[model samples]
Target: MITLLQNGAYLLNNSEIIEANNEAEAILKSKGVVETKEEAKQNTMAYNILKEHNTSGNMEKLEIKFDKITSHDITFVGIIQTARASGMEKFPLPYVLTNCHNSLCAVGGTINEDDHMFGLTAAQKYGGVYVPLHQAVIHQFAREMLATCGGMILGSDSHTRYGSLGTMAIGEGGGELAKQLLNQTYDVNMPGIVAVYMEGTPSYGVGPQDVALAIIGAVFNNGYVKNKVMEFVGPGIKNLSAEFRIGVDVMTTETTCLSSIWKTDEKIKEFYDIHGRIGDYKEIAPGACSYYDGVIKVDLGAIKPMIAMPFHPSNAYPIADVKANLKDYLHECEERAKVSFGDKIEYSLMDKIIDGNLYVEQGIIAGCAGGTFENICDAADILKKSDGIGSDKFTLSIYPSSTPVQMELIKNGVYATLMEKGAVMKTAFCGPCFGAGDTPSNNAFSIRHVTRNFPNREGSKVQNGQIASVALMDAKSVAATAANKGFLAGADEMEGVDFTKPKYYFDKSIYETRVFDSKGVADSSAELVFGPNIKDWPSMTALTDDLMLKVVSEIHDPVTTTDELIPSGETSSYRSNPLGLAEFTLSRRDPEYVGRAKDVYAMEVERREGKAPAGELADAYDKVKKQFPDADAVNTALGSTIYAVKPGDGSAREQAASCQKVLGAWANIAQEYATKRYRSNMINWGMIPFLYEKENLPFELNDYIYIPGIRKAIEEKADKIKAYVVGDAMTEFEISIGELTDDERKIILAGCLINYNNTSK
Candidate 1:
């Protein structure tokens, strides 16, 4: 269904693809295209949008100032706190704070609602927009209110994509948002653009999630589009609706791309018209000749209803194949669970099989991906044609992405149709997508149309011997499976079903009545509100001349995600309290990580108090002193670090790295980072993003690695750093950090982004 080009190709008037091979020049000459490859590269839609936002006046290296920025409750509290510490008097641009992820006040008493109140007060004091709880998710609100043609938006959530609306939006960590609030630029190198050439239309039952999964499956494992911009072009641009393209666009984050933009048409303009923002719509397309670094050609007609099996969104398979080989597929999922869980719980999908047919307990269609108006309406049509979902163990829940979408659904009768078919309708909340709401029973299986399906993401604690898994599917398939009374089924299996494609009616009154919009006017006299759960950041010291780091955790997993590093669900309420949230660091992947890091932190505390470290730490310091006589307790900072094969795979939550920093972590040694956002999080938190490429390490867990002249190396931009393992004997190993901007270097020297900004003030 998806094919990746092996060589760079040129699009001729957005119609024909001419591969840039030895004979490419001759082919281009015949078509009256005379631009060279280097000149043609700037003709892409991504390059044009980027050039408009870039303040550095250089394409090779970019310093971007976004048009707008947004955050949700799980992240807004920390972002605003960081900005306040950095001497930010008011928001420099349009900022939207949406209370979606932590909207549920069920956990941690009043913590969730307290954050919402704080958001409202901050918006008023700082002159920003505040969308009330249950009004809308972050991305949905951004799409309806903030997205504009050729505009750029930065959000503190990972799935922040509005390319289908002709906007290049990026989802980054909270630190980036804080920088923007301080009127700082986002620094990076120019990203490559990949063309997603589409042709034909999708089959009857195939949804946008199916097309997205097929593309992700082809590109994720091979790093085809990693850190690149996906520019949608060709005939396929005209075949999909605005919402269908949006559904596909949001899932592009799973492929690890930096951002995305698309060729716009009247359909996109109509979307703006429907939302009463027609002025924001404009046509965008490639020039006569444009070059792409790579191309992913999608055959929409060939795409089947797909299911991304447990543990990852990239492990995709056709529903037909999975149903044919039920036993084999279940066994594969079991094996993958063992790798992730490591015998912590007895996990099994075999019992879910009844009479050789796979069965699931629950189905959810929620969050930004599946909660859109188009996906939910199509699902409602499918459910209306079948017997209601039975009352046994099978259940279904539908959550609209925003109150506006819910209101239209109510008027259009889509909500009643779904409710009549035994589907529970919930308000706009992102809790189910990130493990806060609708947690299933132990060993239960659920099918969702959400962003991710990582382990423990469904709110089942592996530490408590509770294991539940989620598989990602399109909303139509989930509705069909619910109609089957829990038996595995795809929407394609339902014959003669009329999919009454409904027209969406946008309602702005729902938001105008409840949301708090400051209209970019700050109130200097407004008092800030604070709850007991909200706390300021703890003090952090600058980098020392030399360093001694203990390896607290060693993870050999092929990839380590942010959820495994700090976890979600119950811990989300503590995001605003830095020290409080640090306690859950690595709680899911390594239960002992917190205690081990705390022990090293205690030693550092003693050293800071002018006392020598006791026991093994003292012995390790003594061994380090034997080689470097100048390395003393005063000069050498003591901290902890972790070694992983590849870290920072999923989620743009800054807590993954900040939690490590709060627990006295000084560095992370990894072969390579999975996403650019994660590495930026580490740099902003004052942790070294060390690159150790060797298969075998010179140190193990609990071993100390001492680096001499660490501060000098960072200041000098040394390509290679020398560190010694303080074991039975001092063994030396080389480590290096990849390219860093001058500002990034200053941030590390000053301890963190907050301190860096403080020094500037």
Candidate 2:
């Protein structure tokens, strides 16, 4: 269904692809495109967008100022507090605060709504926009209001992609948004551009989720498009509807791509026009001779009804194949669960298999990936054609992306059709997508159209001995399975079913009547509201000359996600309070992580207060002093670190790194970072992102590692630093850090973005 190009490719007039080789240059030259690969690279849509937003003169390294920025309730409070700490007078650009993630207010008593009020007052005080609870999800509101042709938007959520609308939006950590609020630029190296060249139309039952799953399965593990911009350019663009393209675009985050954009056509223009923003419509396309670092060729027609099994979005398989080999797939899921959950919980998919068929307990169609107008309408049609969704363990829930979409569905009768078939229709809250709503029974299997199916994403706490699993499928397939009373069934299996394919009518009044828009005008007299649970960030000290770091937690997971670092769902209510939220750090992944990190943090606290280090810390300092006599307790900052095989694969939540910083972590030693956003978050939080490539390490859990002249090494831009594992004797090894810009190095020295901004002023 999807093929990744083995080498760089050239697109001639955005129609023909020529693989980069000796003959490719001649083919391009014959087409009257004699430009070199370097010159042609500038013709990509991503290159042009980056060039437009880049404040720096050079393209090799970019300093970008986004046109707008956005955040949800779970993230905005922390971002605003960081900016407030950094002396931000007003928002430097347009900002939208949406209360979708924490709208339920079902967890952490009064904390969720308290965050909503804080966001409202912050918007008023700082000059921004605020969307009330249940009005719209973060990405949906951005798509309807903020997305502009050829513009850029930055959000604090990882799925912040709006490429189908001709906008190059990026989802980053709150630190990056805080920088924008402080009139600072987002710095990074220019990303590679990959063309998603499509050629065929999707089959009858295959939806956007199927196409996205196929692409994700092809490229996610292979790193074919990791940290690169995916620019959709092909004849197949015209075959898909506007919303279908959007559904696929949002899932690009799962592929580990930096951002995404698509060739804008009349359909996209109509999309803007329908949303009452015709002025924002602008056609964008690749130049006649555009060069891409790589290309993903997608055959939409060949894409089957696919399902991504538990633990990852990349674990995709065709529904037909899975049904044919049910036991084998269930066994594979059991093996994978052992890798993720270990002996912590009793997990089994075998029990979910009733007789000869797999039966799921719940089906959810919600969030940015599933809760779109087209997906829901098609799902409603499928359910309308079926008999009733029987009253049993099986239950189905549907959530529209926004009030506007829900209103349109009401007008079109799609909403009533779904409800009549026993499918519960919810508001525009993002709870189901991130694990705050409709949690299934223990060990129950659920099929969702949500973004992720990682462990505990369904709100089951493994530490509490509660374990459930989620499998990802398209909305249509979920409806079909519901029609069959939760038995596994693909949409393609339902014959003679006609999708209504109703036209969407955008109701702008839904937002105008509820959303608070400041129009970039700030009220300096507005008093900021703070809830009892809301708390300021704890003060962090600057980086010291030498460092002593203890390895607290070591994870061997091939890829560690942000959820494991700091979980979502109920714990998200504590995001506004750094210390309160830090209490839950690694609580799910490693039950003992918090106690270990806090134990090391206490020693650092004692040293900062001019007290002598106690117990093991004192003994380690004496050993270090015996080797390097200049290494004193005053110069060497004691802290903790974690070793992960590959950390930071999902979510752009800064708390993943900030939690470590709050717990007195000074560095993270990993084989390699899974995403650029995670590494950036580490630097922004004043924690070192260390690279240790060798399989065998010089340090183990609770082992102390001393690195002398660490501050000087960063200041001098040293490539390699000698660190000795403090044991019976000093066992030395070399660890290196990735390239950092001058400002990044300064941020590390100043001990985080907040301190750097304050000291810079």
Candidate 3:
């Protein structure tokens, strides 16, 4: 069973629970460590082993000098554009741009491939590396080349986790990476570190997702590990393989943690060696007397197969629990669908959970978490040992994490085994995980081993009256579900199956030959190629003395994900072009959101040039002037839309916030932010993260809200804020912005991270 520790606990000595707590406290006291109540305060470890290695100051402020960094096509274009605007002349560090996400450019049009060409030219001009489309997915390529023990890496994607191999990897918005490219430091208050102590070996049925979901459910809402670094340590490290550990590591983002790391050993060394990077391996472990702010002890022996229901990852339950209480669980899933799917479409999970049995229409094992070799091989073994149950009603698809893993599986006859059992294997692609590949029929129920099961993540386009649902499960359960002809089944029930673990063989020739490498050489003479679809960001105006925003949409969904705002799949190709992408903002959530925003945008554009706004916008401006009694006392700014109420949750996709900016959204007023990365995305895009404290709202959509002296408030770094809604009552609300660093305030004041960087340049 997994348990939360009230205090730190010692593990190495196998001491009694009481003695373990005492030993932990004693170790801390002996090393001159003290605890504080400050949320963001820095606490040194019980011992100073880092000082012996580097003789450096406290790790709170660090100078990270990395050999290289990497991002993919969907993300690199934005990062590079930001960096270039920030005075980046060349790639100071080796930056590899991989193009696996937008590989199938021909789907929508040839324009997506043109963006790839642009990326290739940028790599050549900027002295960077470029992996052509289909070479490999971003994380797999990085695992093979970039990770090093004790080294820190950052990515723009939320799933950017490599802790299983000892790298303290963080997934932030594009702005953070742009800062690095411009040779700037990542600034944040030193975060707390949590020890995830594990013991006991997991049974054959329990997989990484099972363990990860359990931890996520415990720590997500409680903020147990929020913004802290999770350091995995214990004998459990030896019981699992590198891939299994990686599956758990990637889900750390769901805990709202800043980053993650694990003690490295021969398993990590073997991982590096297989990827032909023996030199990159460095043994890393926590000191024997290391201290943590909090501790979570997980006994793998008790972990059962888990599934994260609808809406959020935190809505998790064990398979056995769901089976025993199918009616309640299914009802909960339906209620969640109402908020997640909205009124745009009708969806029900009760049909899938018929006769007290959960029946899924589709099963997928893909993406960073489930696409590993061990996951695929285990699934293959289960399928091979079972009868060839061919049913058209149930479909299964698998995508290996990388080309190398695919090659290894093929060589070991696992591919043939899966194919015989009617499982179709695809290439290394992230589309299935984020709503692009293998889209299901309307109202279809799917079980996936992917990272997320957020609504509309299955490429359903619910706003168009099409809908599909997915449940997050491990590879073992997915395979078992497929074996049972789409009936949801746990892995433990299947006996007499030996999951043969095979040695992984890495092949690097595919990447070495296909990918373009500049080897850290800058070429000033090279010219960047721009596609027709590629467009520059529109000029953003500074915050006016007073601001007026018409709330185009106000959502009551407890959480709004990036997928709902901008969607994935066909719309993903527009990410490189800000204005082009803006057209898809809220396309899935509100089919008319883009048009409504544009209508408001036109008026704002007219007003910016000192022209009278048209339609109701002009009338609203006149009404505001009547109250002020001085037409010129406050300046007016224009924007097409402003989304209000609790929003900005899930995914580090900057496009979630950026698309709104591109669509002429002045700001987003919310009760609070869901993730640090999403809030950072808004700041980077020059959108105000207006906080509203009132539990009940006094404003409606399409109503103008004015916040006077906003520019002055930002300059003075004011905490409490007041805004008035334009109505007969002139409703007012109290809101406050939480603590912000000097740099953060400046970035918001300057309109965007890019503009701030440009001014510095």
lDDT of 3 by residue, 318-362 (tens): 888888888899888888787766566777777776676987788
Which tens-of-lDDT digit does each residue in 510-622 have in candidate 2? 78888899999999999998999999999999999999999999998888888899898888889999999999998889989999999999989989999988899888888
TM-score of each: 0.99, 0.99, 0.92
Q: After superposition, how far is residue 113 of candidate 2 from its true place, in Å?
A: 0.9
lDDT digits (tens) for residues 1-761 of candidate 1: 89999999999889888887899999888888889999899999999999999999999999999999999999999999999999999999999999999987878888888998999999999999999999998899999999999999999999999999999999999999999999899999999899999998999789999999999999999999999999999898798999999999999999999999999999999999999999999999999999999999999999999999998999999999999998899999999988889888888788888987889999999999999999999998888888899989988999999999999999999999999999999999888888988888888899999999988788668898888889999999998898888898988987777888888888899788898899999997888889899999888889999999999999998889899998998899999899999999999999999999999999999999999778998788788778877779898899999999999988999999999999999999999999999999999999999999998988999889999999999999999999999966799999999999999999998889999998877
Task: Report residue 576 deviation for candidate 3 (angstroms).
Answer: 2.0
lDDT of 3 at 738: 74
Model 3 clash tally, residue pairs: 3
Q: After superposition, how far is residue 387 of candidate 1 from its true place, in Å?
A: 1.3
Q: What is the lDDT of residue 142 in candidate 3?
A: 82
The global C-alpha lDDT for each of the candidates, from Candidate 1 onward, is: 0.92, 0.92, 0.77
Clashes of each: 0, 0, 3
Instruction: Note each model's CA RMSD in angstroms.
Output: 0.9, 0.9, 3.4
In candidate 1, list every pair of residues with a backbone clash: none
